[model samples]
Target: MDVKTKMRPQILLFGDSITEQSFRSGGWGAALADTYSRKADVIVRGYGGYNTRWALFLLHHIFAMDNRSAPVATTIFFGANDAALPGRNSERQNVPVEEYRDNLKKIVQHLQAISPTMIIALITPPPIDEKGRMEFARSLYGENTMKLPERTNEAAGVYAKQCIELAKDMGINSIDLWSKMQETDGWQKTFLSDGLHLTPEGNAVVHKEVVRVFSEAGLSAEDMPYDFPHHSIIDGKNPEKAFRVQCS
Candidate 1:
């Protein structure tokens, strides 16, 4: 890249399916892009159905340390799959809570190595609703649905606790989606679409929380400068005059 070429600072959203699906209509990632418009680029590095153990493989690839234009901040949101109940169809995704915690630490460490000043935020897996999971399974498999839910709120809580503790130990930002969503009545349906994934309302919650944390950390969009001159400041008769100063 040419040194004179302007590149917008970036914000990376990385994690599992939830993060992957965050750019859907009314999704949190889209909301973030809108919020950071002209200030920074929001990049999504989500992998559907991925867990922390699997995520490690792509860390260096997705965030090459040598890249001169590194993201200003990143959000690591995994664990929903890692919390899968053992002995279930989704058991393959289950990871020991301790291992999950360590993987998160490793991810954070790598990002810091890339850019020590880059902000890293960890988001806990959202709560699981066994009934919702079962219903969703039944819709696909009818009576053939698994006899038991592949995930449970209790198991998710365990992982969420580990995530929260890890964030505190690492001195980074953390979002307790598990607890935050449950604070609302009927969150199982209101915030979650299929027990695990987020509904639009749920995405709104994430967007709100992320903005709050970022704002407190001195990353509020209001404080950020636009990458180029605002339209209002541009001279209609001499557009080059406005851009030339910035280009120089």
Candidate 2:
């Protein structure tokens, strides 16, 4: 590790809905904050329906608020809403890959310019409804359910991989939570209780994996019991279905 990278990070977390939850909203951000509270100042800057472009806008918004000597660690987890299917209120989808990569790059350049020693960590967006959270939700909801375009698992996997590769090429520190969550037991089993979100238990699964990354990055945590709150937006428990939680 570079001596410069060892400095404490301000930990400005930016992303879409999952990362933007109540302090106790039972999502990964809260859990992560709990783990690293003693080690870093974890600031949450997440927006529910924001996409890559929206996040890029947010980076600039944050830059207006933060400057040199502001913070060190920066982690970004955007793209879930960006990849959302076009709908009544969702015009945020398939933002061009080149543009998406550029959006990230621009954020990185600005961070580097302001904080030359900042530990800017770019995270691949988490997994989506690879196991049919929507179909399961329909089954659970009956006619009361609204049908959404089936988001193919292939899309999420490919996009996440691309982002990881791009982050690596850009020389940003990265925590690949997508791969980490896939390896944890009974994790993917409940990864998505909804098509594009996670239940509390699902977030707990993710919380553990991300804290592991933080620990590896030299942040420490106090051990806590795992508490999972299951959401039924998308539902399934078959271990067989759970096994499909492979990460490419």
TM-score of each: 0.96, 0.71
RMSD of each: 1.3, 14.6
Model 1, 141-241: lDDT tens per residue?
89886998899999999999999999999899999999999999999999999888999999999999999888887799999988889999898999999
Q: Compared to the true structure, candidate 1 yields what TM-score?
A: 0.96
Question: On a 0 to 100 scale, what is the lDDT of residue 130 in model 2?
Answer: 44
Per-residue CA lDDT of candidate 2, range 1-248, in tens? Answer: 43232343456777777777625578777777667654555788878877788677667668654544456566777666555544522444556556777787787888787777666666666666545665676677775654554354555566577678877897766766566566656554566666567778767765765666656665544442112222332246553443334211
The list of candidate 1 runs beyond 4 A from truth reads 1-6
For each candidate in the order shown, give its overall lDDT on alpha carbons. 0.92, 0.63
Clashes of each: 0, 5
Q: Clashing pairs in model 2? A: 9-73, 10-72, 193-234, 201-228, 201-229
